[model samples]
Target chain A: MKLHEYQSKNIFSKYGIPIPKGRVATTAQEAKQIAEELGGRVVVKSQVLVGGRGKAGGVKLAKDAAEAEQLATQILSMEIKGLPVRKVLVDEASAIDQEIYFAITDDRASKKPVLIASAAGGVDIEEVAAKTPEKIIKAYIDPLLGLREYQARDVAVAIDLPRDYWKDFTKIAMGLWEVYKNTDASLAEINPLVITKDKKLIALDGKMMIDDNALFRQPDLAEMRDTDEDAPAEIEARKYGLSFIKLDGDIGCMVNGAGLAMTSMDVIKLFGGEPANFLDVGGGADSKKVAAAMRIILTDQNVKAVLFNIFGGITRCDEVARGILVAMDEVKPSVPMVVRLVGTNAEEGRKLLENANMITAETLADAAKKSVEAAKKGK
Target chain B: MSILVDKNTRLIVQGITGNEGLFHTTQMAAYGTNVVGGVTPGKGGEWVLDGKIPVFDSVKSAKDATDANATIIFVPARFAPDAMFEAADAGIPLIICITEGVVIHDMMRVRNYLDQKKVRLIGPNCPGLLTPGEAKVGIIPGDIAIPGNVGVVSRSGTLTYEVLYAMKNLGMGASTCVGIGGDPVNGTNFIDVLEMFEHDPKTEKVNMIGEIGGNEEEKAADFIAAKMTKPVASFIAGQTAPPGKRMGHAGAIIEGGAGTAADKIKALEAAGVKVAKHPEEIPTLL
Candidate 1:
C-alpha cells in the first residue's frame, strides 16, 4: 500500500530522520494554519500515489501562510494523473547545497535487501539509469548481519560525500534501512537528501510502500492504506478473499491458480481473444467464493464471455462445478461460459456441469475457442 | 519428469488445521501426493485428514517424522514468513508458500534467509505449483492441466489455467506448470523458473505469462535471449489498465515507467520471445 508523502515523513521523523516540519491539511484553512506555524516559506504538495506531481502542477512554493493557503486551495481542487488531491502537505522548504537520493528495497534476484544511493538526485532515477547508469550505486545487504557500517560507508563514498559527512551519511543510511525493515515497507525512499546551505543533511521528500501481506504485523502502518486511491473492484475482491485483477479485454477468466490465470489469458489471445480480468478463486474455493468472484467479474461491463478452467487436484472438480453452478445461480450471467474440467472427480464435475446449458470443452483450447466465439458473438 | 514435485515427494502442509489447508490437503492426498504430515503449532498430535497424515507442532518435528522434502503453506499472511523460514531451516528444499499478504519486508527477510540457506522458495502470495499428473502442490485447478510437453510459467494464476486450457484444446499438454506468485518480493522469479524450464527436456515449448511489475519480465527476456533453446510464447497483462494504477497483482503496479505491461512486452519481443498481444493468441503462437 502507498502512503502519502506527509504520512511517510511523519514516520521518518519518528525514526530520527531529519525532516522539515510538515502538516497534512484537507482544507485551505488547515494548510494556512500549518504554513503560519512553520513561520516561513512552505511547499504545498498534493497527496497522490502517482509521480510527476510537480509536472502536473500539484506542487507549488509559497512565500508565507496566505500564499500557502492559496496554493493548497489550488492543489486540493486540482487532479494530477487522474487522481484528485484529497489532502495537501504543507512543509517548510529547505535550501539545498546538493541533492542526493537514497532508498532501501527488496532485490528479488539476489534474494536480498538492496540499498540504492546516488549523488545525482531530485530527478527520475530511470532517467539516470538510462542516461548514466554508473552514477547509481547499489549495495546488497545481508539479512542476518543487517546493514553494516562498512556497507553504508561504501554507499556514502560512492555518492561522493565529503569525508566530514561520511559518518553522518552512514548513520542516515543505516537509519533509513532500519526504518524500512521496521515499517515492513516494500520501498522506503528519500529523494533529495539535501545538504542544506547551512551544511546540515536532511530528507526533503519521503515516500514509502508498505508490504500488504505484512500489514497484519503493523497495525499502525496498515491504517495508512488509502482505499480512496484503490480501484473499487479490487477493494471488493479483497473482502471476498479473491485475487482479482481487472483487465481490458472482453473475455472474463475464472481459474483457481495464478499461473493458470495468466496462461489462460495467453491462450485467449492465442485464439484472437482478450481477457477482461484475471480472477483466481484460490485453492478449494467453495460455491460462496465462486459467487463472489462472479459478482466481481460481472461488474466489468467489458466482459462478454466467462471461462471456467479447473484442474482439480487439491481442488475437487465436483466442488468447482458446484461453485460455478452456485455463482451462475447468484450472478445470473447474461454472458456465455465455457468450462474445462479435469483431474480427480473431474468426470463427476463435468457431469454436473453438463446438466447446465453452458458449453463444456474437453480441453482448454476448445474452451478458449468457445469462450472467444461467445465473446465475439456478444460483441 | 516434473520440475518440482512428483509422487515420491513427501509433503508437509503448514497451517493444516485452517479451513483452506484442510480442504486442499485432503484433495492433494486423494490425488496420490505423499502428504505425510502437517504443522499447526499446539494443534499437533492430531490427525487432520482421516488419520492418513500426522499433525505436528512445528516444521522441525514434521520433518523428523515424515522426512518431507517439500512444504505447501496455507497460513495467513501474518505468519507466512515465519512458516517459510521454519520450513527452510528444517531443510525443506522446495517451499511453496500459498499464503498471501505477507509484508514485502517480511518476505524480503524470508527470501534473504532462504537464499542464505540455499533453499528454494516459490511464493509468499502466489498460487503454488503443479507438476501436472505428478504431485500438485499449489492452489491451481488440476483438471485443466494434462501432462504433456509444454511447460507453463506465469505470474497470474488464473491466466495460467487459461493458457493450459488453450494448450489442451490445441492438443498441447503441459509437462509442468508453475505460478511464481504476483507479490513484488516473491521468493522465485520468472527467470529462475525459466532457467529450470530451459534444462527440462520434457518441455517442448514454453508459455510465459507475465504482468506489469518490477523488471523481472525484462530480466527473463534477457535470460531467454542468451540461453533458451525452446520456442517461447509470452503475454503481458494490464495493457488496458490506466497508467499509474495498481492493476490487480500487488506487484503488477505500473510505477515510474518501470513495471508497465507495454514496456515488458516490448522487452520480451525484442529478446526474441514470441509476444502475444491478447490472451487468446497464445495457442496459435505456440
Candidate 2:
C-alpha cells in the first residue's frame, strides 16, 4: 500500500507539516500549468512506489513552466523499475540551507515504531546505515503513550540540529509521527527535509506505505490504491479472495496453507524442481476458490506442472479433491498434477481424486517425486 | 507439547457476532479449542454462538469472567491493533489477530506496546495458528494436520496446509503448525517461532516456509545456523515473481535486491538448512 510522493505530501500538509506547493499531473499540459502556477523553478517527480526514481531520471528540476512540462513529458514516458510513470508531481523548488532526513517505520525485533532522523539527507539512507550507523539517530516510540516530546527532542538533538532549529525539528517530528499513526502507514518518510534560505523547515519529498488491513478504516486512503500499479494476476487474485504470489519456477503450486506452500516449494527444489508460483486457496475453500486459484496459476506460462497438496482439517479432503476436479475442468490444464490428500475423509478424497485419471501420491515424498517427474516431462 | 497453545488453553473470540468472526469461531470451537467466551462491544450479554461461554462487552470483562489466557481476534483491520492492545492490557498472554489490512504503523505501535507489556502477538494479516489434535486457531484446514513430531511454520495459510498435505503423504504429522501472518510489522516473527520449535522436544524436524519479503528468512537462517539443533528444511516462495509487484502477503515483495527467493535460499543454505526450490520438494528435504 505504498503512496506516491504527492499523496504523502498531501497527508503531510493536512498534519500541519509545511510542504512546497505542488500539484500532480498526468499530462504534459497539466504539468506545465502546475509549474506555471508554482512560478519560478519546479521539481518534477515520477509517481512510482519504488525508490531510486532520481537515478532512473524520474525526478528532474525545471527552471520554468515550459521546461517543467518537458521534464514531465520525459518522466511520464520513462519507466522506473518497470513501472511506467503515469503521473508526476510538479512542486515548487526550495533553496536549501541544510538537508535532513526523517522517517517513521516499524522495528520488528523491538516490536516498536521507530523514528529515524539523520543530518545527512538526500542520499540513500541504507548507504549511511552501512557506512556510518552512528550518523543515523533512531527513537522507538510507545504507541499508547505516543511520541513524547523528549523522544522527539532526542532525535532532533541526535541529528545535530542547532539549538534554534531544535524546536522546529521537534514540531516536525511530532507532526510526522501523528501522521504515521493516524494514517495507518507502514512507513512515512521525508527525505531532504530542507531548511530554506529563510531558515524555515519544509518537507521536500514524502513517501508513505499504508497498511492494507487498515484500509477498511480509512476509506479515503484505500481509494488511493492504484490497481494499475499492480500485476494483472494479483488484481484478479484479490478479486477472487485467493492469495497468489507468482514465482519464477517451472512448477506451479496450489496448496492449502502458507507454511505448507513454502515447504512444498522447498520440496520441489530439493527434488530438482523449481516452483512457478505460491498460491494459497485458504482453508474452507470451495470449488469456486479452487477454480479461481487454478486460473491465476495457469496464467503463469512458466508453470509446467501443478501440485495439489491438501491437508484437510476444517477443510475436508473430499472437498479439496472436488475443488481440484472442478478447477481442472475449468482450466483444462495441459500440465500434469500431483495431489497428496490427508486428514479427515482422506480416503474418500483420494477416491474422488483417483477417479479423475490424475496422478495421486500416497505420501508427500511420493507426491513430490511424481510432481517433479511430471514437471520434467512437461518441460 | 505445543509452544503457544494446547488443549488446555482457553480461547476468547474478539469481534464475535461479525460474519467471519462468528463463522470461524464456531468452527474453531468445534475443532476442540477451549473457546470459553466472545467479545463484541455492544452485543455483549447475548449468545451469538452455541457455546456456553459468555459474551462480554470488553476484553477486560471477558478476561475476568472466563479467565481466558488466549484470544483470537477476528476484528477488522482498522480496529485490530486496538483489539490486540486491549487483549494485551487484559493480560492475555497470547493474542492471535486474524484480521487483515491492519496498518503497519498501527501494528508497529501495537507490537511496541505488546513488547512493553511482554505479550505475544501472532498476526495482523495471517490465518492464525493450529496445534493438530489439540486446537485450531487460524484458517488452515484442521483435517490436514495430525499430532506428530514435525513443526510447520509459514507466512501463507493455504500454503502451510499444502505442506502439511505433502508431509501427511509421507506419513508425517505435525506437533504444531503456525502461520505467522504476512504483514511486515507482525507480532510473532519467523525467528521467534523457530526458537520455539528448536526448544520443543516434540518438534523433531521443522519445515520453515517463507515467502518473498523482508530479511525474515535470512534472519531465521542465521538463527537456524547458530541455534537450531533439529533438522531444518526451508522453502521460499515468489522466486519467479515479477519485479515491482506485491504478492498477496504485504511482506511478499522484492525490492532493491532484498526479499528475493534466491537471496533467502542462499541465506538458508548458508545456515545449513536444506533448501527446497518448489513446494513439493519439502517432503523430500525433510
Candidate 3:
C-alpha cells in the first residue's frame, strides 16, 4: 500500500501543501521535456518502492537538460535492491534555508495517531529519537476532534520555527493531517520540509502508506497501486481472497488463520524442512477459492510438497475438505500433501481426504513431521 | 474458581442476526453459556435460533429486560464502535468484541469514551475468553478444552488452541483461556489477564503466548517480575518473520527495532518465566 514519492506529493498538493514543481518521466526524452519546462537545476529521482534510493544511486541532480536526460536514462536502466526503476520524477531543485521533519503514524502504545516532528530532518528519525531524543516532539491527536489548531502550533514551536514562519508551518501541518485522514493513509511523511531562500516553506520529499482495509472506500487511491512491486504469488492471492507471502523453502503451507499459517511454517522448520510460502485461505473459503489457491501454489516450482493445516472455528472442516478435493481435481499435480483437519466436522473431513488417498495427520506436530518426510521422499 | 465468566455470566449478543453472531451464539449456548437475550436493531421483538433467544433492538432495551451482565459483539467493522458504545451506555460490565478490521481511529475514540466507565473491553478482533466446561463466549473451540487448574492467555486464535491442545495431550486442562487478540489497541491486555490469573486460587500455573508485535509481552514481563508469585510459562511466535512488515495481523508487526520474538523471549526469560521454543514445548516447560 506504499505510494511512490511523486504520487504522495500529488496528494499533498491537493491539500494545499506546496511541493516543488514536478512531473514524472518514464523515458529519457520525457525527462528532457520535463526538465526544459521546469528550467535550471532539476533533481531526477527514480521511482521505486524500496528505501535508500540516494545511496543506491537512484537519485541524481542535473545542471542542464542534456545532463538531466542522461541521468534519467541511467536511473531508468538501474535497479534498486532488485526493483527496476520504471519512472523518474524530474523536479525543480530547491535552495533550502533549513530542513525539518514531520510525520503522522499510528502509535500502538497510545492507540492513537501520533505526530512526530523534529527540528533535525533529512535523516532517519529513529536514529535521532534514539540519540538526542529531545530534538523531537510528539503529539497525540484525538480521533474525535482530530489535529487541533493549538496542537499544530505546539509542534511548530517545539521544532523551534521562528514566529514569522509559524503560520505557514501550521498551515502545512493541518494540510498534511487532512490528506492523511482523507486518503486513509496509515503513514504520511514529509522529510526535509524545507524553508526556501525566499522564506517560503515547501515539502521537499513525501512518503505515504495507505491502509489496505480502507482501500475499498478509496477507489482513486486504490487505482494508484503498482502490482509490479508485488510478488507474482501475492498478486494471484488477492484475486482468490487468500493471504500469501512467498519464502525460500520446499514445504508449501495452507492454513486457516494468520497465526496458524505462521505456526505451520515454524513447525515445518522444526521438523527439519523449510517453508516455501505462507498462505492463509481465510475463514469460510469455498471450493473455488481453494482451487485457485492450490493452482497458485503449484505455480511455484520450489514447492515439492503441500500441507493443509485447518483449524475451523468460524470455518467448517467439511467446507475445507470439499475445497481440497476440488483443488486436487483441478490441479492434478504430482507433489504429495499432508492434510490435518481439526474442529467442527473434522471426522467427516478426514474421511473425505483419506478416501482420496491423501496422507492425514491427527495433530499439527504429526502433520509437520509427515509433510517434511513426504517432501524429502518426493525430492 | 475461573476468571471473567462462569455460571453467572448472563450474555447478550450484539449483531445477533448476523452470520457470525448466530453461529457463535448457538455454540456458546451449547457449551452451557447463559444466553439471556440478543440485539439486532431492526430485528427487535423477534425470536432467533427457533425462539430459544429473544432479540431486542438495542443494548439498552436488552439490558433493561434481561439484565444481561456481559455482551459479545459480532458487528461489522463500520458499526462495531457504535455497538461497543451502546453496550457501555447500557452499563454492561464486560464487553468482548470479536469483530476484526476496525479502524484504529474508531478504537481510539471508543477507548476514550469507555475510559469514563468501569467496562472491560476484551477485543475488537479477538476470539473471546473461555471458561472450559462452565461457559464459553467468543469462538474458541469448546471440545478441546477441559476444566482444570491451568490458566492460558494469548494474542492469537489458532495458536491459543495449539497451546491448549498441547496441555490437554499431557493430561492437563485449563481453568480459562483468553485471546486478547492481535489488534494494536485492545481493551484487556496481557497484564490484565496475568493479574486475574495471579489472584484466582484455582489456577496454579499460567501460559502466555505472544508474537512479534507491540511491547505487550515486554510490559507483561515487567509486571510478572514485580508482582507475580505463581509460575508462568511463555511462548513467542513468528521467529522467522521478516522485520518491519505486517505479518497478517494488524498488531503483528515489527517497528522501530522493537517487538521481535527474540526481544520478547529475552524479556520473559529475564523475568524468571520458562519460555518455550514451540507450542509443543509449552506444557513441558510448565
For candidate 1, the C-alpha RMSD (Å) to the true structure equals 4.0
Task: Estimate every model's Cα lDDT from 0 to 1.
Answer: 0.82, 0.82, 0.88
Candidate 2 stretches with Cα past 4 Å from truth are: A245-252, A262-276, A299-305, A313-340, A343-357, A362-379, B1-69, B73-91, B97-102, B113-118, B121-182, B187-212, B215-245, B253-286
Ranked candidates, highest DockQ first: 3, 2, 1
User: What is candidate 2's TM-score against the reference?
Assistant: 0.82
Docking level for model 1: acceptable
Better of 2 and 3 by DockQ: 3
RMSD of each: 4.0, 4.4, 1.5
Quality of candidate 1 docking, DockQ: 0.39
Screening candidate 3 with a backbone cut-off below 3 angstroms (N, C-alpha, C), the clashing residue pairs are none
Select the stronger candidate by lDDT from 2 and 3. 3
Alpha carbon deviation, residue A319, candidate 3 (Å) = 1.0
DockQ measured for candidate 3: 0.61
Q: Could you give candidate 3's per-residue lDDT for residues A18-119 as a string of tens digits? A: 999989999999999999998958999999987789888898999989999999999999999999999999999888898899999877777778899998
What CAPRI-style quality would you assign to candidate 2? acceptable
| Highest DockQ against the true fold, candidate | 3
lDDT tens readout by residue for model 3, B232-284: 99888888776776667878878877889889999999999998767878989
lDDT of 2 by residue, B98-148 (tens): 776676667766776788899988887677888989998866667666789
Which model is ahead, 1 or 3, in terms of TM-score?
Answer: 3
